[model samples]
Target: MDQTVSTVIDEDVCIGCGMCVKVCPVGTISMKEGRAAVTGKWSLNCGHCEAVCPVDAVRVMSLDKEQSAFGTFDADHRWLPHGEYDTVQLVRLMSSRRSCRNFKDEPVDRPLLEDLVKIGVTAPSGTNSQRWSFTILPTRHAVIGLAEKVGGFYLRLNRLAEKSWLRFLLRMVGKRDLEDYYHTYYEYVEEGLMEWKQKGRDRLFHGAHAAIVLGSKPGATLPKEDALLAAQNMLLAAHAMGLGTCLIGMAVEAMKRDRSIARFLGIPDKEQTFAIIALGLPDEEYQSTAGRKLVVPRYFEG
Candidate 1:
């Protein structure tokens, strides 16, 4: 197999301060001949060797300097110390964050959605491999169109799921839960499809003004976890910014089953859809935060 990553060291510029050796999580770097060298046994290409090199002697060859953003921030004022905001303020924000199903008819600007994406990507990823991408459906019509396509697919799915043979097949495939859930959904929508598509209510997206889909590389090490982490970051960021958002797993499942829907959403053919968040201005108000019971955990004390 071809080597996906490699690291380089500049012996001439090396101070041999051992920062790279100390910071390497895998212990691949060691001091040899008063210079840092990698053992290559446990190297994950995580770039701690490159980051801790005070004199820039260590280089992670897999990193693309042209494509990467470095020295892009004004560090003096932009970087903050630990006690920036109190715990009470953070708790209030966390308590206020909720899944918003209803939204106003007003349109959200593309720039604001862009800001959410910017913050979302700041989330940490495995091996610093930032393999997340965001697609913003900024218009109400675009969102509704995509929802309609997904809804139509679901309607057909509901029909097929009701058949006895299909249900038996699903049970054989260990999808009894899915089979039962679809059966329940079929009964719910059996009344009238037109009535389900009311003026202000969208069954899939709940009339949100905009939608954001978080995608991951097709073969990433932790695609689903990374994408959902980024999604949560974006969701909380949206809430903090006075915007309402909802995480919709149905959108991801729908896009995965239909290539046409994925293509229409501009998802890369080689990428997988992991998360979708509906974004919009709030149409309703919440008087208080809903309380929840904490799950009890078994302790393993030494």
Candidate 2:
């Protein structure tokens, strides 16, 4: 292999968990002394291996590239009556949001995350109950721990379905795969279930810089509409921060069923966990589209 193009795995940092080995696209890496050991000239084709090393053991040559994408958007020019530019800016923010699932390995900063949470508080709640709470889940270790427990439960249920004649019947009804996802489907439910499940969760929460679990008391004075409104506010604030968010559904559903997860979250039995979201800087880019069609419910427009 060319010394100019090389890879290094920090033995002390690596868990020797073999995730990267399974995820390697070219299959050039293996574990040695419970740590990742690169082998074969295929190691020469080892770019993918460096992408998902959760522990940062695998050093990629390009990881050091500077990322300074902050506050690049501008729209101060007035284009309409009243707060024209600012109104346009509001439209812009909404259109920019996407269900992001890709994220970098860097941990989200706590202070920044709190700022995002403050924006969440602005959302309206029924009768001012404001019954919403946000919990941030960071770190691969915590994600893996959650995935293992949840994934085990799902895998076991799936196996039970397979053993029964119902497995054959489910195909007809649309209960495809029976399991939540075949492999690497849910970072919190699927650890190494994908064909390359062993590789790593380089993209958990879609690599979002942070994660949020938003919920409200089961029967709080706040209306159900309040909960949803609050989540939308949080989402917009994250997007404006140059952060992408994936509104997680299935994984949170599993947590709802599993009291153990709720316990970890520290929610009292009286409260219910609602919308969950993952936050981070977006890796992929696309042009923006605005929902400015002006669909007024025309009450007899003269």
Please write out the lDDT profile of model 1 over residues 1-302, one tens digit for every residue. 12244778888899999999998876778899888887656566677788778898988877665433323222232435488868898887888899998899899877678778777876777765678878889999988878887887777777786788878887998889657766577766544345555643476787898999898875567878889888988888788777899988776777888878888877779888888899999887889888879988899998
Q: Report the C-alpha lDDT of model 2 over 1-302, residue by residue, as the tens digit.
A: 12233567787888888988887755567877778886645343334566667776887563332221223333232225565457777977888887786766666666566666666765656544455766767654555555555565566655555454665577678886653343334343434345226665543345455677777765456545666787798788777776778876765676777777767767676667777787666777887564557776858768
lDDT of 2 at 154: 62
lDDT of each: 0.78, 0.63
Candidate 1 minimal-lDDT segment of 10 residues:
68-77
**Candidate 1 RMSD to the real structure:** 4.2
Quick one: how many clashes does candidate 2 have?
13
Clashing pairs in 1: none
Off by over 4 Å in 2: 1-85, 164-192, 201-204, 290-302
Q: If scored against the real structure, what TM-score would every candidate get?
A: 0.77, 0.57
